[model samples]
Target: MSGFESNPFADPVDVNPFQDASITQATSGATENVGEFNPFAGTNSGKTIPISAASSQPAVLQTSMEQSAQENAAAGQASLIKQQEELERKAADLERREQELQTGMENNWPPLPSFSPVKPCFYQDFEEDIPEEYHRICKRMYYLWMCIATLFLNVLACLAYFTADSASGVDFGLAILWFVLFTPVSFICWYRPVYKAFRSDSSFSFFFFFFVFFFQVAVYVIQTVGIPRWGNSGWIAAISMIRVNLAVAVVMMVVAGFFTVNAILSVILLKMVHSKYRRTGASFTKAQQEFSSGVLTNRTVQTAATSAASAAAQGAFGRNQEN
Candidate 1:
């Protein structure tokens, strides 16, 4: 038998496995192929790798990147919400401040100054200031006031007349009393009633004013006649004084002119007022209704009623206590 064909039961012979030339040649060739390989070589130029394969990213790393991106988006959204809240807070603060400022401005006591320090007594354009409907009536009222004020001149004239003649103290006193009593009385009784009558177009008020003013007009005529010891210098007195003393005559004439003005104005105004009354169709009956309504609704009437009630209550209480 040959050595290569030894039986399995026989003792194994120690031999060098490296002594095989073919195995040594195969290992040397594999080493040479590995040493000759170069990854940086430019021969594979046109070949494209899939983007996913070229990146060589792990699945865990990709998932973590996506989660980080989601987290960043959430943080950005939170920051935007915070900014909006901050802007809203600022807007609310500004609105509050504006409201406070407006309230402070509106609550100012003791009102601000007017455009002009002094107010005008007389309106420059009478027509502009007075309503068109009331123009004529208001003008008459103004004229009445003017006439009343001019009576002071009459007093001066009368005093002058008395000084020139045997002026009695009683006459002078009567003149002063006439002025003081007549001026305000005329205003309160005649002029104001007429004014209100025309203003309201009330028939009753118109009739009332007509009656009172008729008497006033008669009084004006009498005053103009210049009766002796009266407040006025009548035409006769003026003429008589003219022959006596030129200066006295001049003063008397001036007073006569004022009297004449008052008389003529009163007559003309009376006619105008009559025409107005006719146009208005105001009657005494309607005037009475208006007066009744006014009295019923008047604050003064209400106040008087309240006072009377309280007084009655107090009196009843006192009587009860006495009983």
Candidate 2:
């Protein structure tokens, strides 16, 4: 009788609300059961059932994805660590190689000792220690030093002569004394001073050494002249001693030659030093300026002045008190 009733005469049409309702209820109940089901839930035998493909497929895929991501992250971290370690090792190797090369280069030159019994005053490995610009001048100074040493040997040779002739023991003793006195004195006074002057471009030291060394050059000349009765083999003794004994003559001649060589070298080196000093634009005026500056800036001078001023102040105070 209602619109929901089935029409069988005109057109075959069914309208069954209860049937549709029952179908919907059945579907909803099945969905509820599926949602309530747990794969890890205990069974009658206390064992969990395996999850159905429909429920577990997404979880399995998600777990596999997470595990893959973690593995990739771990692999990336390991690779970065390896790269960092390799870079550090390479840097260390490079630094070690550089040090080895430096050591090898340094080994090429002869090393000088800090102290020596004979040559105790100055020690410098010219090629390795001095600046390139000063090498020529320093070499000249070293040659001069060697010449002084040779001069000592000449004195020893003269001493040997006097040892053979006991009557001339005075000359031998004097020769020995000269060797002892002159060797260290010349080195410390003239040679070392000139070395420092040229090396430092100092005008005052250069002039001071010049005046002292001029006297040294004069002594060399007098020795080369070879006056008789002296320990040195002047030209007079060198030729005359040859007739007495061939060995004595040879020693005297050698000594004479050493003196001549020393004289010539000293003059040459002096000229060279003068030229260098001039090239540096150093002059007497500059030397005076340096000396004045040195005296003005001296600690002792300043201290003395301070004491004098304080004493004067105290004296004035005493006089004022008396007044």
When superposed on Cα atoms, how far off is each prediction in RMSD? 23.1, 19.9
Model 1: per-residue lDDT, tens digit, 1-323?
Answer: 69768787765876678878998999999999999998867866767779888677787689999999999999999999999999979977996896686555432222344675554321133343344787777676657755886577777777777787875344456678888888778867876676666555667678778889888889878878877766677676778787668897798788788888888888888888788778878877787888787687578998999999999999999999999
Q: Which candidate ranks first by TM-score, i.e. highest?
A: 2
Candidate 1 segments exceeding 4 Å error: 1-134, 239-244, 309-323
Put down candidate 2 lDDT per residue, 1-323, tens digits, no spaces.
68758555754666776679889899899999999988867654575557685698899899999999999999999999999999979977986896686555533222346463333223445565556777898788767866776557666767766755666566566666767877777877787677767666778877778888888889788778876666676677668766667787787788888888888988898888788777877788878887888677678998999999999999999999999
lDDT of each: 0.75, 0.75
What would you estimate as the lDDT of candidate 1?
0.75
**TM-score, cand. 2:** 0.54
Candidate 2 clashing pairs, residues 3+ apart or interchain: 226-234, 226-235
* Ten-residue region with minimum lDDT total, candidate 1: 120-129
